[model samples]
Target: MLSGVSHTLRGLLDDLQAAANLRPGQMVVVGASSSEVQGQRIGTATSLAVGEAIVDTVLAWATELGLTVAFQCCEHLNRALVVSRSTAVARNLEEVSAVPVPGAGGAVAATAYFRLEDACLVRAVQADAGIDIGDTFIGMHLKPVVVPVRGRTRELGAAHVTMARTRPPLIGGARAVYDVETARQRLQGV
Candidate 1:
């Protein structure tokens, strides 16, 4: 049987997908602290099992949608992220040298690092959407224009989950008429 946290995470993923309306090539960054999920201090307790479960669920969903998933490292590593090599190339993110481990990168990031296919540590990323679990501070990785996503489920396990999705910046503030049709057309397949 899956754990309660695992079930909660799956629901969170579904909510994110629906609310974010992410396109196939878009990205979602996740910053999770397993210790907090277990109701402990951020890095005081690391659970490989919880980390692996969350990573697996996110990867499955992202792969199904043809989307990228980035895992943010703990503050010990300056919050660099683990992203696929392709993501680094496509997003023009700087690759950093580091293999995330439990102590340095927290359980979620370390597990993601080891399990991700063709993964690399990147200096930063501007993701289309994000989830910050246990106040891990994922906002730094999201795009400039962010809209908060409030779902029926606000907490995942013992951690407080905050979600956000991004939109393209609106320009020509006053006199310009926003082209709603064009924007809808752009996201027609999402």
Candidate 2:
């Protein structure tokens, strides 16, 4: 049975995946504050149950989408991320030495660390997309050219949720043509 928070998060993640057109193996960074989810000040209260719901829900969606998920620790850990060993190896991310505890690393990250197989901490990552629950600020983990995704489900429990996807940086200036059709039309002087 899914908790209310889990159910809401599932819908939000589904909407984000569809809107962003996320592909298999793409990475999604998640930063959550279980305290905020329970309507408490961030870091003031940590709920293991809320954290479990978040980690479980996100992992289930990641499995279904064939995506890689990273959980961001709180600033107490310098915002390090918990990822699978495979993800660290595949992405060539430097491994950090530290175990996440609920009080320091944030509940969601701590839960993820235990839940993920061969879990390891990485110093940093540039993921394809990100989910920020309770304004935990996942922006730093996302790739360049971040675009906000407004999903149908706005809040997870009492926490405000924000989602984002990244696109490749647009290099050329105004004279640059984006599509073949546009290039053709410009060449024809139409």
Candidate 3:
């Protein structure tokens, strides 16, 4: 089961990266419900082992991509995220107290808290990308210009998967120049 989950996640993330053009040092937020992975209702049948598998898989993948990953806790923890201390400091996220447990933070977050090199909880983050397993609702952590990424492999175990990546929001009206060359030409005309 662990191997299967890891493999599925790897494929999904690969597709996301390909479509999103994610770069190094960017962060990805993951929200997972082990109960959903097991075909159970959310918060009904948490599985620590499944959570461990997910955290391990995601961390390994992120390492290979030179990206950061954060695991979001359940609503019980106010949806706070589990991230590395370095990430928290670098992103200027406010540190919060409280260690995640299976009962409160859910299995995935608890596993990430223990697995991360220097795990800490943060109130919020504007992640570059997101992967939601079991309908965990990871939208809150993503940047404003969220774009959904669809891949061939949809489900992870019994859970539904949703992925997204963000881009800088497009501002200004139709007349606003979006390219450097266009802007330069317009300025010269002026």
Candidate 4:
């Protein structure tokens, strides 16, 4: 189980980096459900312990890569995100009130809220990249022009994983000579 967690984390990092070209100080939104990852229904078997373990692993990796992370709450919070207050201000996001709980926000978001430094809830964020574990629907938080990312592991436990990155909208359709290398690089999982 631990090995599977590690592998999933590694693959997620690779896919995120490749898809978004996430640079230092960038924000990425994560929507997760530990229960789903542990082969349970999305919110049925919420586990703070599992959520903590996943958060610890992800935060370590994100810190090393110089990326900021925002954990998305479940539908109860209208899918609001939990992030550091600093990140909220930096990104010009609207801060909201309320702390996450397992029932209202899901265990994953609740765990993030507890772990983050000076955490705050935000109504929305135009995140540079996003990972959706168990199909929590993170598209609303991502920047425009969401491009899907296919990683080595399609599912983490029972949860299906999905990723997306934004790109500049291409105009002048037929005659446009897009940056082939950049497009290819993103598709190649860099």
Better of 1 and 3 by TM-score: 3
- Candidate 1, residues 1-190, lDDT tens digits: the string is 2378777887888888899888899999999998888788889999888898889988988889998999999999999999989889988899999989998998888899888878899989999999888999999899989999986688877888899999889888675557878667667953
What's the candidate order when arranged by decreasing TM-score? 2, 3, 1, 4
Give a tens-digit lDDT track for model 3, residues 33-97.
99998899889999999999899888888999999998999999999999999999999999999
CA lDDT of each prediction against the hidden true structure: 0.88, 0.92, 0.93, 0.85
Q: How many backbone clashes does candidate 3 have?
A: 0
Cα error, candidate 1, residue 182 (Å): 9.9
- Which runs in model 2 stand beyond 4 Å of their true positions? 179-190
lDDT per residue (tens digit) for residues 1-190 in model 2: 2378888999999989987899999999999999999888899999888999999999999999899999999999999999999999999999999999988898899999999999999999999999999998888889999999999977888889999999988878987787889889988998
For residues 162-183, what per-residue lDDT tens digits would candidate 4 score against the true structure? 9888887888887565898977
Poorest 10 consecutive residues by lDDT, candidate 2:
1-10
TM-score of 4: 0.88
**Weakest ten-residue segment in model 3 by summed lDDT:** 169-178
